[model samples]
Target: MMDSPDSLVYLDGVSKLYATPQGLLPAVRQVTLDVRAGEFYSLLGSSGSGKTTTLRLIGGFEIPDSGRVMLGGEDVTQLPPHRRNLHTVFQNYALFPHLNVAQNIAYPLKIAQLPSAEIKLRVEAALEMFRITGLGERRPAQLSGGQQQRVALARALIGRPKVLLLDEPLSALDAKIREEVRQELRELQRQTNLTFIYVTHDQEEALALSDRVAVMQQGRVEQVGSPREIYDCPASLFVAQFIGKANFLTGRVLQTDPLTVMVQNLPIRASAMGYQPQLDETVTLMIRPEQLQIAESQPDAAPTAVQAATQAAAQLSVNQLSGRVIGDTYVGQLLQVQIETALGRLTATVLGKASLSSEVNLTWLVSACTVIPPALATMPSP
Candidate 1:
């Protein structure tokens, strides 16, 4: 992957393993990743998904059992952490309690044997960069969680490394402060134009802050794409379910067209997304919850009005289905409605408040449905 022109960091078929009482375990499978210069990329996954281990390998804190780690087209797999040109901001902040904020930020510069004047100048600039100039003389105990986080960031950026590794740095902060800090970190990355490699399991944070996201599961990358692509056109059933809430419909393809598939004897249409299914193929169609619209089903309404309205919806490529409301849940800004239909139990996310009614119509765009392999769709949970 490093053969590319502007790629800054590349992991070529990297893998790491550990021996425990249970036996040998693979922490990171044969994974290959390429991060471009000045791009915000995130490794998003749950616990034990090998994200933290992968970051450590790039920083030279952990060596890969096989394959190479390259930086700026040069091999650095065997180099020590100190020999690498990158800095890490850990989740715990790892600040020193004995030293003041200024001293903590200036420690790296002092160790490099720079002149005192240059060290002082860089420390002052870093303090100002993080908006903590007034807290320079304060100790870690005297600062709030947000303030201490800024100090850690200033220390990491003071040396101006080529790459910055963030290992769930905002996980320690509260929700309100975490959002504030997330915005600050994004703005900081933009101003410096530094290549940031962030690791987190929070989908919202990853989607909001990253230019691209790499979703990992069981030590391997499930998918890598922009937020929209990952959410809309997932490569596999696992990916579609992982990125967000999706309703899966299992069916067999009776016929195929350039832009549509006949699933379970029903012709379903989709926008031009390059989808081509073979005849008699069993596939699972995925539709996101937010894409569905729910309206009260009127049995006594005139068929003419319903037909006209249905035709308009179909012109926009919307698919219609009749279902009975099984349950309704209030979740903040949206109401989660579960319905029982011929396709099975489906969940729809309706905006604002919705009346808990018995009969309803579910409307979704055909372009929103993604088809995946049938075996994976029906795979039993482990």
Candidate 2:
């Protein structure tokens, strides 16, 4: 993968094994990842998914049991933490209670033995960058949680580390403050041109902030792709269910084509990205809530594409599903509608502003459906 134009960090088949009481627990299993230069990469997963372990390996905090971690074309798998050009922002905001903000930000520079004037200059710059200049005189306890978090950030960035490791840095903050800090982190990274490895379990945050996201499950990575790619083109049922909210239909494949697949007694034609699965094979048809459309059908669309409308009973044909709106709930800017179709219960998210009827009946373009082969490795395309 480094044969690409801009590969900056490489993890080659890295694995970590722990001797548990029951048996060996593999925290990370043969995961290979390539981070391009200046990319805001997020290792997204639940706790114990190896996201933190990956970050520590990259930062030289822990050595991998197998494989190598490379940075800037050099192998640093065995390098000590002090020898690595990296900085870490812990979730706990590991600030020194005895020290003020200025002192805390200056700690790293002091350890590096920089001149007093230079340390002061760097601390001032970091405080100014985080917009916490005035709070620098206050101890961590004297500041708000947000301010204290920024102090931790300033401390990490003060040393001008080539790579920044953020271990759920915003997880400790409340929702309102978390949003603010996440934005600050992105802006700080862009302005400083720093490569960041962010670990987070929040799907929205990962999608909003990362240029690329690595979705890990159990001990191995399930998919490595852009947020859009992973969100829309989930490679596995686990991914489809994990990354965000998704509705899947399980059925037996009867026919197939590059543009469509006949599964679960439904003919699903996706937007030019379908694959041919063997007949009689169990397959899952996956579709996001937002991808589906409701109400009257449009001109120049397929007759078999839209699901059968409950109101227009006689007009139904082709891929039309026979389902009823089981429930509809308002979710801020969207309406999540659950329907009982022939395939099973499926959810569709309509725009908040969209005009909805009490008894919802809908039709979707064939291009919106994704046919996922059951137990298959590759996921259904968007």
Candidate 3:
């Protein structure tokens, strides 16, 4: 598949193989992806899910076994790393210990044989661009992790590559500093208008940093969409589970219109989006924990709670379940309450201040749920 004219980087049916002691292993399967010019795109997955390998393929560090890699609409699959106009920043800030900050940033320019005066001007500009103006004389060992990362970025951007490939570069920083650097990286990308193809195993980092994300599993791209689209309307079970915490219920299709399914023989109202479901087909239902609402009600208290549950269930636009509050875990501002429903165990998130204990009725709007067909219900292991 050829990349669109707007794409700065394109990978078409790319695959990479490695020989391990276990035998020949496939690090990356037939994957096709595109990153628009000046866009921030991310390849996200778990360790060994082929995200880093995909980034390496884009940067020309590794060639694909059977597919083409195009940079700016030109084939670069057989090109050497130095021949590509893309630069990569590895997880470990690869800085020379012997060189000072300015020298390290100017190395690429020096290698290009630019004038000494030009090198000095660009090096100083790079330092100020990364907010490390006065640290030019300091060695990499003398700088903090964040500072070292800045120097690495300055060095990579000093040459003004067409695209930047980042391989889990911020994984080494502390949580606080990692977040701060995330903002800085985004700002820098905007200021430079450089296409960034970032790879990471951190789910939150991908969601927070990328304009679009390609979720990979077992060397294959499970889904590609904007962060919100990926999170709210996952294309497969792997994406639903990988992108966020999802509560799943095994069910069978009850009706295609107004979307209804039967979970443990109980009719569950759901939103099926544009999917056409055959009646009585077995399927899975997914809903976010925060979408569920809980209210304290005794199952045996004067039949009031039972009446309410029944009424809620009768409504075709809502799914209702009564359960016992088995336990609750406090996560920041939300309390994740686990409930033992009649069908099985389920979890719901409510405000931390909610009085959650004993019998409770769980209700969630149909619009907040997603129905997954049986084909996309299972995730292949990497």
Candidate 4:
């Protein structure tokens, strides 16, 4: 694929391998990505997914076995880290123990051989920009995790690099501080208008902080899109299960137009999105827990078996299912309820409360659920 004209960083068919005791193992395999200028793009995946390796390749710290890494339309795949127009803020903050915060932020400028007076002025401005002006004299050991993170970011941006690469910079901070820093990071990126390529294994962090995210697995990208696209319309089962909580139900395709599938002797209507599944082909249906609506069932109005079957058939036109509550847990403002239905056990995140072992009706629109083909099924055209 051609790189976008506005892309500040472009990875073209990049691949990396490591020589271990077990022999050569691929860490990044034929990955291609384009990060638009001034956009917050993230590489998101668990450990061993090669996200950090990919970031290192971009930073020119790790040489790829094949392909090129381009920054601002110039190939820098073989260049040294200092030669690239980018700086990396590592997970541990990597602050020098002996240097105070001002000196740490000024180190990059010092290395550039700027005038002493200019360096002092820039360091003061950076400290004020990062809200650490009063703590400039404190060493890394004397500061909090969040303060250290600010020092690291200040040091990185002090160089005014074209792109800033972060490798889980907030992972060491406590939850509250992490959130605060995450928001500050986003705001800083917008305020500076600098492109940011962040690497993280935390799905929530990626979804909340990034303008777009690339989901990586086994050294390959599964999907790349906006957070809402990744969460609401995942491209594969892996992505569906990885980004958030999803409930899956397997069924065989009964029809193609306005796609219908049969699950547990009940016909389920689902949206095909862009996928085309053939009749008789088994497919999995996925729905988010929050998409389902649950209500208490009227036990006094319970219908006979035949009437219930008729009602089920009629309800198939929409999406409705009857289930008995098996579990209920309070999570913040929402209630996580698990129910046992004919198809299988499903979890629903709803407001209010639900009693355990009580019959309830679950309803959702056909568009609320997506049809995912089997592993061997052909993927939709790009």
Clashing pairs in 1: none
lDDT per residue as tens, model 2, 1-382: 3434466778988988878998988888888888887889999999999888888889888899998898888899999999888899887888998998899999999999999999888888888878897887898989888888888888898888878889998888889878887887888778888899999999899999999999988767888899998887776787788888887766665545434456555665443243456766666667788876655334555456334354355322214554566678899888988876776777888875333333444566555566653454553321
Tens-place lDDT digits, model 4, residues 212-297: 99999978888899999888888889888999899999989998887898986998888888367899988888999999989989
All candidates' TM-scores? Answer: 0.92, 0.87, 0.92, 0.93
Q: Model 1: per-residue lDDT, tens digit, 1-382?
A: 3357788989988999978899989899888899999999999999999999999999999999998999988899999999889999988999999999999999888878899999999999888888898898999989998988999888888888999999999999999999989999999999999999999999889989999999988788778898888888877777777788999876666556534556555666544352466776766788889988888888897679888887886756778888988888999888999998877889999886556558888888877877764333343221
- Candidate 1 vs candidate 4, TM-score winner: 4
Winning model by lDDT: 4
Model with the higher lDDT, candidate 2 or 3: 3
Q: How far in Å is the alpha carbon of 103 misplaced in model 2?
A: 1.6
The TM-score between candidate 3 and the true structure equals 0.92
Which residues of candidate 4, in runs, are more than 4 Å off? 302-317, 373-382
lDDT leaderboard ranking: 4, 3, 1, 2
